[model samples]
Target chain A: MQIVVDLNRCQGYAQCAFLAPQVFELHGEEALMFTPAVPDDQRERVHRAAAACPVQAIVVGERAGPGVR
Target chain B: MQPDTLFQRITDYANRADPYPLYAELRENGVTRQDDGSYLVGTYHEIAALLHDPRISSDYRSRTHPDEAMIRRNERPPSFIGLDDPEHDRLRRIAMRPFGPPHSPGRIDELHGDITRIAEELIDAFRGADRIDIVDEFAYPLPVTVICRLLGVPHEDVPRIRAWTNAIIDSFDFTPGADQEKRQQAGLDARDAMARYLGELAGGRRGHPSEDMLSALVNDAGPEGRLTDVELMATATLLLIAGHETTVNLITNGVLTLLRHPDAHKRLRDEPGLMPRAVEELLRYEPPVHMLPQRTPLADIEVAGVTVPKGAPLILMLASGNRDPLRFDDPDRFDPEREDNQHFGFGSGIHNCFGAPLARLETQIALGALLPYLDDFHLLDDPPPYRRSPLLRGPRHLLIARG
Candidate 1:
């Protein structure tokens, strides 16, 4: 399983960046600076980073899901 | 005598501001039992263990649940936190669906803007005031409004519900010789009244869908289907109470703590990016939900060789765990940059805080926004007087002067 963040809804709390910076990246404005996807080897980091998102905008799986909006 | 016991004192008002010492005393051992037959567990490891134990029920309907007479007089089944599985599992699932898939990504990301907007509005109210009581002025309205908006509760009813919410929380105190009956009844009246109020509010959304949790619960067709009338009321009660009460304390504690610890306050102001970790540290150092609902030991439970007999009460001090020197270096130090901080601010295991993500976001935003503003402020008291309930710990009023 991998992680995917919908940039459209991301407000840049950077919680993902804080929890698993190895996989998730936070820009200066707090939005995703890089891709949220993680390799299978980094699934643990991806899962934790996903869990860390307060808005629950991070999706974890082989595929990305629809946006809340 | 265990110093953790709050049996002494001419007034129980001292409980609100800081229950940390009592927690420290309780942390000195496995568990201490009060004369009233209630127990207190302040050790983080022990609390974590009990929180994870299935036998330790959070539900009042459980065999070892708190007596109805012990709870507020007229409230229906207690909050979802005070509930056992099956029902707890059912309601928690529905309550959480719209929020997120438990540990999934942040779906509430869109609300960040709205939350910021709300925070700004509340701050607007604080602009000209010379002295601000954190409770009445800032912390209180922030979370209360957020919950109201989240649950779709009408803002007009907030005052009434807020009163009921206070009454319900007041009833949970375990202070010796305290009139539990009066507080409990007030809590009961608050619950029924709030339930009736929320029930009416939710009624209109039955056929009509709204973008709120209540609407989601009302229309939920998940594995458990929609919430029952009773369950719906209970869920609303939980959201309104849990949504604000715990968070308000957390936000207030964060501000008051900063005002007292000017250095930490300065560091946060200089480095606004650290607000996230600061929020975590604040949670550990001064958590909102101080003690959890009572837990009854099943059969015989042994912790580090001491056996807690069946039916014995156990209280888990999560905040104390955050300060445990065994787990954290200088556990009491309010360091926002403190690494490896796996504090139990939101409890842990299955019943961990469902709204933790939202709560964290709110605090980070509120604190991050307010840090610069509070930099010039000073605490009027070394330790401001606390609220009455040990369960919901925080200052009743924190006076800060920017001048």
Candidate 2:
């Protein structure tokens, strides 16, 4: 699975990072860094993170393409 | 049939103890337009969507009928919570720097030992006591001290600061009263006074940096530029109030719920690892904040098939959505181990509770510390007297006694 985070939309609530730290990391207050390609073991965590994103900035699965809403 | 009084009834002091029934009625009614011309959105999905929608404005000035009090408040700069982005975003980010990650990553975590120590100390004061008022002795003081220590405010000033906070919060009462104007003016006056006090406090730390948030904020020279004097005052006051006010309710409400559900309380005490999840459940089951009373729509937005006209007062029933059967399985049940618990306890979207990490840690430690003593604790008042504001609903005092 792949993930796409709309950095513009992300407010760095860090819900994603809290749920899936390995997949998503917040560098500073607002800068969010994430692993785009999810490991099989991390698939569940990534899905949870996406759903838990306060701004809905995280997109996962095959539909996770650049500039995709 | 008379006009729908669901919103009115929900805000009524009589229903303050449990507004869940009215909320269920609201969800059944979908997006409801009250006689007062405001709209109430109670369903889980709709409230969640509106919360995320930028079209929903948090600024009270956007209301269709901006009153004298609101205009008076306008004289002072709006805090980040009341402003829209990029202004809100900017102030919030600057405020976040000293509180949490990635900057000051250990800020909240560093408070763990202090929080535990504080909770234990508060509990220790309960020694040889047959009864306790959780709100007064335990819940209120713990967060107040933690926030004061974090903000660099002298602990001696808490009584004065709390007076200002009370006045400000009392101004938010939704129920129409004869002294509404008086209350509003007092709220504004209190805000100004509090801001002045906070400004002086922050001013003292301007050049010489200290360990507290106010010091960091006043001395900050990040790329975002420093907060103006007014901004610093507003931001500092916001942190101080937000740090303690809601947290007091969270701790009080958590203890109240646990005492009501002894089985859950026992389970929690038996397995302390469930403390975090139990806190989340407490947020969902009996959240500190019950509603967002000041939201306005920037545009005519269709919600649940009803179009909420622009500038109309939009009250989001967060606690209602937490119990919406459509959202959670057995929404009324207090299940600590429940998963997929994305609750509005801290709210969601851009204006989500900034002090959530600290609040969570505080509550968990508080409840964990008090769990052992709760085995013999019984509620002195089942539906305890609630606070005045329905928006920030919780018991004003939770009297518990040893069996």
Each candidate's B-chain TM-score, in sequence, is 0.91, 0.97
Which residue pairs collide, candidate 2?
A28-B102
Could you list the CA RMSD of all candidates, in the order they appear? 7.6, 5.2
Ten-residue segment with the worst summed lDDT in candidate 2 chain B?
B1-10
Q: Give all candidates' CA lDDT scores.
A: 0.70, 0.85
lDDT of 1 by residue, B136-164 (tens): 88888888888888888888877897788
Candidate 1 segments whose C-alpha is farther than 4 A from its true place: A1-69, B1-12, B36-38, B61-68, B71-75, B102-106, B177-179
TM-score (chain A only) for the predictions, listed in order: 0.71, 0.88
User: What are the candidates' individual DockQ scores?
Assistant: 0.07, 0.14
- First chain TM-score, candidate 1: 0.71
What's the true lDDT of residue B137 in model 2?
95
TM-score of 2: 0.88
Relative to the unseen true structure, what is the C-alpha lDDT of residue B177 in candidate 1, on a scale of 0 to 100?
Answer: 54
